[model samples]
Target chain A: MPVDHKRINGPENTIPYKLYTKLNVKSFKEALQDAVKNGVRNDKRKLDEHRRIFMKTDIVSQAKGSAYIEIGNTKVVVSVFDPREIPNKNEYSLNGELYCEFKFAPFSCPKRRLHQQDAEEKQNSIVMKQALEPAVCRHEFPNFQVDVYALVLENDGSALSAAITCAGLALAQAGIPMFDIITSVTIGIQGDLKLLDPMLHEETLCYTSINKNSKTGKNSHGIVILSLLNTHQQVTEFYQVGSLDIDDIEECTKVLTEANKVVVPLVEKCLAKHVIKGVKESSQ
Target chain B: MTLSEAEKTFILHGVQENFRIDGRNRDDYRPMELETSIITHAFGSARLRLANTDVVVTVKVEIDVPFPDRPLEGKMEFFIDCSANATPDFEGRGGENLATEISNTLTAAYSSNSVFDYTKLCILKGRKCWKIYVDILILECGGNLYDAISIAVKAALWNTSIPLVKSVTIDGNNVDMNVSENLSDCIKLDISAAPLMVTLCKIGDHCVVDPTSAEEQCSQGAIVVAISKGKFSTVFQTGGGSLHPLTLMEKLKLGAKVGNRLEEALSEALSKIKENGEMGFLN
Candidate 1:
């Protein structure tokens, strides 16, 4: 058996199938204009509207705790494993550790992704860990490590924020002690237009500087993702990209803080529903 | 690397009093030494030393095809390597997390077209372009790695020179181009809007810039703000602590203020630096 069998063979370079579609014939500028017209997006959502969210817990039977969430076309599943002894450590630790892994399924995006984690996924894992660390009471399980794995089944946009929210729910479902429920939101900025919970197309438009304003040199374009602990009113994680003015950042923060509130009630309701179901089954 | 309770208390008290172990104020940065063109083999190179932290950055370029979507723009990447010489824990894959974080921050900061124009590197639309690889090596880690790395990367980019393309001809599916043979006939990168990162470590109720390792341990949370020109390119919160929204905004303000001053100082230093004939590791 002299064949190279370590990995499956594939095309040297594969372009996304979406690129060959006839619907993508228009120029990007015209497409961007069509994405949002007359204060309404192509999806008919308002400028500050968020995509409908569906969340559920206890999806993975093998895992200690698991959650699945869907924000429009983007779907993510997060599983949390029980705390185990920390690996390769001899001394005691004052606080427990969290191991986060964020992965995108091969068929999740428009283009096929590799099995191995890419740089973007690795960075998302770190952000996920940081976002959840403050809410978890790590001192209770010192010298132990809890593993949280997030898999993006479909990535339309705001996948990281969805994963963070799902991970928080999974941690809570796993009986992990926490200070408060965490909710995250993403906002896309393009010039003066601010879209809340943007889809993939709007996100791309905001990312690119196609319509840059050169006069002021203050290009208000980028993405701002904020994770908030509602109870304490503390921000667990804040990640931003692109170039923006100070006032724009402040406004974005304010808008994101408010936007985060929209998802808190939904998360709380889901957890409460799960708890009641468990109680009913036990009573029976 | 572990500090005792007494040592922690001492540092906390010093922070509360607006004084630090190194006798610096809340916003005071440690003295820095910067040298450019240290790597003769690299197209451009720079080494920056801020007190105990040290970093080296080099820029390399190669001819490559541009992305289909953005054919007018070239490509740029940031790769950070944390050497074991910086610390024993960085051996093998231990430093990968930190390396990825720093590199990702740099990528986000430079993603904006206004920050660094990529179209200038394109030799032929959608066919040929120059792909720049900025490699950074962390020789030591005292604290404030982001700030130090950003400064070195800016300096290296400033020192970089791209070879000019003489001409290009496309026939059917094949393309041919002639590059300038003259060594001095090259175009320099425009680094005027290059972003520089400033880490604001929140200690007690005050935020400090350029914190030492000891000071980093005593902080609650920190924010890294990358400023380009007068606007902010990226703002990231790191560490395992949470911050109030008010405190976060205040830290951002402080970071911007300090970043402007840093940008000014860096420009001043860069202007004063002349291409010295004798410059290398031996110096």
Candidate 2:
């Protein structure tokens, strides 16, 4: 839906959807079982399996630094160009030049469409930008914007998560120094059944449940989108379940671990392919 | 928009020779990138990019009393917001006028019955109907805003899901909508007739579909055609320059062909969208 401030009729729609999302899943346990069965094969490997990631540096001809990553059907092309000179003189961040845009072609989705960034996409872009900040060596680059434009032509799921991993890979690929990889995962809870890497269908079922009873209500399956740092895999950025309880948090943690099982390796594989071999991290 | 001599000359030269810097023929559109179901939060969402010009569209539905005049037909509205990142020119409210113009154009393009069936959104006669809000957020402007916005809006709509109201309680004036508890208890809008806008920009003696920002500045005039289900839903003119009747017809044919290709490609892409969680910036 196109968000128009002037039109009062539609904003209600956006707000209500976010709030009272009804559940499509029959039960949380059923959804979880379905996800596990559908996402991974009998052998335990993911069905639409993303391969081991590999990253390399200086791939962008015109960019100062760049990286390329492929995770199954998910592929990201990022270019860390010169720190964009922010023209607004009065405004400056001690963190240095920084800008990130996440984009997907209509061709990227199963259904094609025109190009327009909406609220969810915008939020995701900002989330990705934030997730990349600590992970990239922005101090070394300074005063210059690192343009990390992620293009997903094919989607298996977990886009922002992939983008975070991909951006880190790109930073390393560009030979831009970095601290750690910012890996992300999307975990969902139906009832007692918690799952990871919820795809479009699963998401639909998921939201139906979450939207219906947001609180400790019976059919609530809130989203648990989290960003993690690679050193021992700790949480850095989090937008976990909203208004849920401690028990729910525990359920989400289990799902998060399950997500990492699929995502962590993909990040490493991409890093291996794109990052330069001999550029040692400074230890001053 | 003001044009610089060097930029203008560069575009004019490319148009004169029937070639764009991106290597697209004057009549050829830039490679379009489209994704559907990208935004999990929204019931239906799609992102379309015509080269650097990008638009993200999300469709949200809600129950509301119908307009006094159009009670049977549900409401459909368009909202366009131009991001400052696209260009400094769009900073603050600078792009409001343009945004309004494009949104109005879109509304008009999709208003006709042939383009979109508004009655399908009606739940109760004059009581409640699905008010679909097409939120268009322009991230970048490479040119051809009309076509990009229109296509993205349509895609987002096609991806929209109106909650199947199992029942409704008429509590005097305060009515209550009983939403279906069944997860698959839903209805999908058949948007095959939804129109896709194709822009024809005139250059020298010929017209081109999907012009870049530079060429848009150089164009004397342009036309926007909204085609639905292989038929021309609506055709209107844009830009400062006007067009001859004969030339407009010729361009209309070209626009229709392009629209067909776009619709086919879009349908195929949309059909391929899996329930898998493969979305976001990193594909």
Candidate 3:
């Protein structure tokens, strides 16, 4: 007798499994238009508007410095440790090192994540390291390495951008000398519509190509995450998923850079509060 | 963290005189704060802070096949991850050894049927059962890790809400379970018989219940005793020191006495916890 795998092993499927079934049942073009129409997105935000941000510093007492950030439903916490001598490197170098580790708690996302860091998490860590290396004064502490760990407590959308923003704030709070602070934003492109700080549902729809006309086979859909050094007006790191036209890419980049600027002031205000508190404690 | 000879003498004399550095008696514990149902996505969750040590536990439930030998029983697993935020030494894979040690100790303590009833988790005797995954994340380590972890695990288990099985239809090796659709239709686990572990650190000729990091370094040996109800469920020795039989027996007696009191205090705290209270790292 042949065993029925669908009946026995199918109970463990997650929400994504149900989502795929629903997608196949409906017309793709109709859903796309419903998500974006009449100068507003599904969440009732304007085309270029970003989500509300809440940020704080010195949340984790164990770490040397820490920050917690929340944008809409996404929550991220970053902790920075004191600088230490680079391990397993017998020879000395002039430039200091920055080690980044990005992790999502097992219960952070809709689907359960494994305890070990997956490949996507490793890639995000490298992106974070590259984004902050130029802004940080690595030559200040020769032969030493600073460790930064970012953990996502809840991942609704744009989690990597939140991590980058929080990690930079944590490093500054640790008193590491930096040329300037870095900020990041995510942009979602679908057809002629551009969504800023898209939610989880909008993000998934943006990634899936829904060609209004199947005969043309032409679809412009992608997600771009960009980190910017606002003080210097330079792009530090850029990552994109899926395919988009050259013209659409340029349009998305311009919108994301402007969005990044809106977040810088929030970060500055949080850091200023932390500094004032420290000065007050030392004087007393 | 090396201590000089004079510093060691100070700690030894302090323990002998019963005047600890923090002014606590031998069987006293530090102040602890506990919050449950913190993680929104998990079936059950809890966060515990014992002075400087912080631990978060989340429980996830899934349907799984019962073991061939034990058809009526369910399964429970413990996974521990030590975050680098606690200390630089736990970076990367460096904390694997400590994580393994803590998880193994928990597995041993929960292995007995009397300590935690596994049959309550069963949906269908020989076909399907509920597998509980208890994931523990250690954010900080001050000392007395075993005692802190055991208490947090018990509290998290108490907070767990397993979905009620409305019906189970079996058709020739195919089992289909219909769980209750209402969110409030769930069963809370009965954790009264769950074991509580107490770490007794022998300093000089006396033993202490909660030892700070400095005192842990000065102690000669330590014994972790897990008590379920009035009996010992599991007892094990740790650290690099030898213990005389007489002193070992004395420490075991002290551990049992402290374990019972700790269980009573924990259950009291759990009962006082209000539903929908403010919970998380923010406060």
Candidate 4:
């Protein structure tokens, strides 16, 4: 009965586990070349095309405002609580606080997540907060803190972008004042192929490996996530993983900004629907 | 969530009269929506929504060495996470205490051999075994958390399919296991004896099952009874109020009866559930 040892509280084992058996695996360079030559991806989407997105707001009844976003297999739910007095606040401050906690459900990913938020999740939480900080009208609720909790129900890829986008919609649905709508998109780059909203497999295949043999040209295959304030045309936050050349980074940012433009209308439509439903209910 | 004295009196009188605030009888449960195999990555998963209280349970299995003391038994672990989205109070580590209490209660309820046969999970008896991780996420809190969690866990376990082991090679201190390659080659657990927990809250001398958050606040005391195959697997008193011996017996009886009915209904729903259908929070 190895049950007792399993019951003990300890840090989760961080060892990675492979979900699919590696068979007929194509090298990173070959995969990149195939995408560039054939103009098609494994999922059959064009290199610059994104997965279909499904967005809805006011899904969680308990939270003041909530939204559920599903982009292909990636599903994330974000809830925004009502603003409250900042805990541990002794002196008055003009800036309102934004608290974000991003978590992946224990069974959301290929690997089981621990009950506690891990380092990656904590970093994402901070990134999310920073992404939405400039968009929100903090001066309206000075000395108060608005809590945003994003839970990834399923993670295929581009989860952080989905969270940021979903959180912005949730805040708007919660009736929090904001300067403009915020939207985000993630771009995966491998060689000359640029994938918009790449699925988990494509993302891992493109970004996880770095070509060690390259000594002259750019060997950077990486991911770039950009949060944009659509109306104001401002880049609120930009997060990049892996090494990339200046040209590649510029191209990725341009593609990601374009993708964000496509997502903003969807977010606006969801918020409008929420507001319409609220008005109808009140009238009835 | 404070209730006025008037509200408490109304609830107390309603319970005594066998009619709850929401028009449900003493033993009546709230309408529940259950969906299974929701998480694609998990071996088994289920989401149960009893009114506003939502719980999702996922089962993950791994191979591990058997304990020296219980050489013939496998392992089953329960982890409960209280999502901050459920309530603002659960922010940071604020919900740790409640999460621990619920997980501990589930462990006790499933500890009985009759409730869940752990030996069935054993692979190489004494040497190696399959470790099952039952992770529960509380998405909302309406009330009767114990009952909702138990139902979700049972459904998740029922939906669980352990990968079929093809072969095992023992090489001195090392052992290797080969699992079947076919995706459908798996074993589904027999959950006929899985326990179902029922919470009976005593309000003004009368016990009521499936107490909502408001009724829970009005309850003087409550008993959580875990019933498996018409037998009590575990019983624990909750809340701060005390109960007399006679009252306790009465509440236990009510809990057992409700628990059995719940178990039957759950099995019936599970059997009716189609393998592939529209599921998850979308619907």
Q: Each prediction's Cα RMSD?
A: 2.5, 22.5, 22.9, 22.8
**Worst ten-residue run, lDDT, model 1 chain B?**
B274-283
Best by lDDT: 1
Q: Which stretches of candidate 3 lie over 4 Å from their true place?
A: A1-284, B280-283
Docking class of 3: incorrect
- Model 1: lDDT equals 0.90
lDDT tens string, model 3, A1-284? 12344543333333444434665455557877777789887778898998899999999999998999999999999999999999866568678988888899978976677666665676577667767776688889999999999999999889999999999999999889987888889887776778899877778777655663365755566677777778777566655554454456556667877888899999999999998999999999
| Model 3: lDDT of residue A227 | 75
Q: Give the local distance difference test score of model 2.
A: 0.65
Expressed as tens digits, the lDDT of each residue in A1-284 for candidate 4 is 01244454455544344423463246656655655557887778888888899999989999998999999999999999999999855668677878889999988987678767765686577568777887888889999999999999999999999999999999999989998998989888665667899888677755433453567644445667777887777666655554344456556766777888899889888888888998999999
lDDT of 1 by residue, B2-56 (tens): 7898998999889889888999998999999999988888899999999999999
lDDT (Cα, 0-100) at A5 in candidate 1 = 53
Per-residue lDDT over A1-284 for candidate 2, one digit per residue giving the tens place of the 0 to 100 score: 24455643322222113222344324545545655674563236563333444544456688766666555456666676665665544445444645677777666765443366543455556556656665665567555566677766566566667677767766666666766666667755555545465555554444433333256545434455666665635443444322233445545555564555566666676556443343343332
Query: What are the runs in model 1 whose C-alpha is more than 4 Å off?
Result: A1-5, A20-25, A216-218, B281-283
DockQ score for candidate 1 = 0.80
**Pairs in clash, predicted candidate 4:** A1-B67, A1-B70, A2-B67
Q: What is the lDDT of residue A88 in candidate 1?
A: 73
Those runs of model 4 whose alpha carbons end farther than 4 Å from true positions after fitting are A1-284, B278-283
Give the local distance difference test score of model 4.
0.80
The TM-scores of all predictions, comma-separated, are 0.96, 0.49, 0.50, 0.51
